[model samples]
Target: MATELNTPQNRVRFGEFEFDCITRELKKSGRVMRLEPQPAKVLSVLVHKAGEIVTRQELIRTVWGADTFVDFDQGLNYAIRRIRAALEDDADAPRFLETVPKLGYRLIALISSSPNSELEDANHTASLPSTTLPRLYWVAIGASVLILVLFLAGPAIISEFRRPSPQIAEPVSSIAVLPLRNLSADPEQEYFSDGMTDELITDLAKSNKLRVTSHTSVERYKNTRVPLPEIAKQLGVDAIIEGTVMRSAGRVRITVQLIDSRSDQHLWADSYERDLNDILKLQDEVATQIASKIGSHIISPTDARMAVRDVSSNPNKQPIRPLNIEAHDAYLKGRYWWHRRGTEAETRGLQFFQRAVDLDPTYAPAWAGIADSYAVMAHHGGLQANEAMPKAETAALKALALDDSLAEAHASLALIKFSYYWDYATADEEFRRAIELDPNYATAHHWYSHYLVFAGRFEQALSEIQIARQLDPYSVSINTWSALIYYYQGQYERSAAQFRSTLELDPAFGPFVADDLARVYEQQENYPEAIKEHQLEWTAAGRPKDGELLRNAFLAGGPDGYWRRRVSLLKPVGRSGIGSALQLALVYSHMRDREQTLRWLEYAYQEHSPWINFMARDPEFAWLRTEPQFENLESRIGLLASGTR
Candidate 1:
């Protein structure tokens, strides 16, 4: 029952079934049926080369591509299973894809005519209009096509895709949660409103049925110049949720609207006015309504109760008093600036967090915010480890003591533990506790993923990152982290793609993404691309690391003039950091300045920078690896230092 074919045309005369590749539809006895992408592709591949033995590797390479991270065996099996499901073919008595023992799979089916030929029949003629048509109609069509091209190809494409639709779909599977805007007369209360918006996003994200965009992902659109549909398209969501928060005289009013993204339609709208004690319930209610509007599976009362279970073992404990509004406001301000992550912003965040604690000593959240701010500052080596680490730890502990259920507090503590003390066990405990408190907290998942990566639990790190991505689907930071993980795992192509995707979302991320791509390309032995990506990163970052790396990569690519250009660039900056010395050594080696290379190596050894640890492994230093001076320099830096100590 072997069949033969050519081209991407879908129709295959095999037994009694016809496979339609165009619509990804399968028809048996003229009845339409659904098929998943993988299965459909497998079937198409088989149909196109019927009667041929498709080797396992060929099948995999054709269907999933060689670079695919999926397990080929598992993917092949899954695809065959889906095909069997569609064809009603039993494994024992296969209609097609007969397993050739010890070799590959053979498609045994009668494949006659190209699927495209079937469209020639009058009744089954292609639905599309003929290329040649009435002149007036064609003119109209040309105008329409021109308009379409303008819209699709223009810069407004992104904005247009983000615009809200006016018509709601029957089934809403995707959504964007726009940041809640502050409608308060006093703009100073903006931080509190923003925090509420973030909390709402968290609550919505907990529902697996709804594809809720993360708070951080959508916060950038608070005062967006882009169109709603474009934003929706950028986030890959079908709908958008927007709201305005107003508070006055100990009362809060929140008005929210849900828009179907595709049609720019408003699907649902509601307003709530209540005391702050009802904030938790209000968020839950809003999430429920959104779920209902979007046709999410209704949670039974019992399930709902379970979902809202308290983190504390004692459920009957009295609720704590709300923190001072002034302190909370200050904390929010601090967090607002902290998220900005610039030099001035970090300093301002530290100041505000401190002021918050001063205003209200028992404000646990504010304390945690202070801890996180210090930790972030310490990350960039802007603050002394002793000065920042202890303060961050103290604030985190105080926050936890005041409110053990605060996930942010636990996350901050975990960060402090891992980054400063390297207390793996304590960090793990705190991370677990944070997840228990707020399962949807993206930062908890992100940091936990990072911890697993550093601990060499790469697969677990990937899983954690996946969870973070699910929660923060559109976050540039999360995407960048994913790229970095891939880069670390030596999946250069995938890492480069992810980095490029990050840049698409935020151009400001170009430098970091380009740097990763440069490293990836270098490892791939694509020296030209490596040099190109490095140059891009250099232009974007203009940092010492970027300049040094670009120069080295250019030299590595084997261009004669590159070294001279690099030396000229470095001469202006002077030597700084481990990277600078490494680059200098590389340039010196290229120029046969053995003495200069040794001097730079000595300088690098004197500085115990983390990158120095990679001296033995970095392929860039291979030229100097055999020298006695280089060996001595490496030994001095303790590049082979054992963690057992």
Candidate 2:
């Protein structure tokens, strides 16, 4: 019955426009205007029921048919936009068609059949132009000559039009993988989709030849309506990958498309379906296919063979082991919580990672997750360093033993070596190895920069941190640490600016960043601002009363009084870990109380504080550089003599 409305006699006219149902043509003031087939069909339907409402469901069923597998809401919106464009209609003050809100659309203008008198007038006007036969003969002769010239040059003209544009020919070296859409009927499967997107980003990052944006940067666009080109520009990538993941029963399906950001062209697209157990192979295949399409140099056949080699003796080999379905599920859940970046989330993530390892003890990636969660827990003060760092180190070592080429395990080990064991040389070596295995691992770059900062290699630290910033521009931790690097280099203004930017990304990082900013403010002699920032830090950490007391103490007796009060407050927690003791040492140093400072430094060293590695170069300890106690502490910790800078 809908097909009958697509006939010529059903022509309708409204507001100086005519829609021919038979010819499916839209003409404005007797001139045909271009409209896509879908938009024209939509227009025909709306005009047929002029002055009446047409629901979206009715239009969808009529225009797209019943079983269309697309994002219908987005498609319908796009079609309506096209209709408005073609009709020269304003959606806000619509004259021809009016949107009926959530229902659909309606033709607001009155419609009528085309008058026979107007048709006769149009025919008469057309006949008048044909009366000049002699002039028409001369025009025909001129057109014949033009046609001959065109015939001789047509191939060249056609070739010029058909040639690929510059953007199409340009190689895609960088890409951002947008969060994959979840197509499962159950909302609980969102974790699976997000995890798949993370895995794809990780897989792509393995290609040293391609600069893949980190998942942290791309996760911002999960449900965004922004266009692809705009997102690509923000990520500074040559291309973008958008996809959907659907998990049903024991089978999983993934559909992905690679787009050229500059040209908005689809360079390649494919769909893969496999059992849950084979999902790891599917991920590798998708990554390899995408790398090949982008002309990346890392997808050669030799690299594939190398990826499958034994990694025990060959440290250069890539880890390509498949994961069990149960292990993969637990790993996904672990990562889902891990990205939240809070103490509770870290603890929950650790449990999932443990479950993953328990399900498949050979899964190196799960072990890496366990290591990361434990390390983060320690860093966030959720666990004592002595209790957490050893467990993190054990998990990292086990992961490396299982798969020597696992970059994440190597990075975890590097962090443990630097912070727990104080093995600077071994930490540096592990960091280098992790980066060599996966150059695009932003976390490796982020942590390596910290190592360089402690080693007093400020220039190298700045360079490495900038690389991390480029890879994960939106990562709050990366941005905060970048600011810290600037602070360590005594660039107070730069540090302040970076902290402000990090806060802008997410105010929830206020507690962490405000503490760092407060330090920078204090170093710059901005006491009032430092106190204010410290108060903000305390308030964000759910201790407003402490902040108020500290503020009062600082205002009452200046820096010396502030340190005395801070030291007194920290004394209780100082026994919990080296972090609190190190904090006390810093406060004592600021107070110029060499005795208390040395006492806390001894305690920190005895507890294997990570900050102990920075003592030789820390500006706070500059006053104690020549002190015998400080010298003895440095020597005991094996500080390089050249670290005086």
Which numbered prediction scores highest in TM-score against the true structure?
2
Superposed Cα deviation of residue 625, candidate 2 (Å): 1.5
Question: Against the unseen true structure, what C-alpha lDDT does each candidate score?
Answer: 0.64, 0.75
TM-score of each: 0.56, 0.74
Model 2, residue 348: distance off in Å is: 1.1
Tens-place lDDT digits, model 2, residues 377-491? 7766777778889999999998877667778889999998987787888999999999998889899999999889988888999899888888888888899889988887778
TM-score of 1: 0.56
**Top candidate by lDDT:** 2
**Model 1, runs deviating above 4 Å:** 1-175, 185-192, 205-211, 225-230, 237-239, 248-251, 260-267, 274-319, 524-645
How many collisions per candidate? 25, 2
- Please give the range of 10 consecutive residues that has the lowest summed lDDT in model 1: 156-165
lDDT of 1 at 600: 76
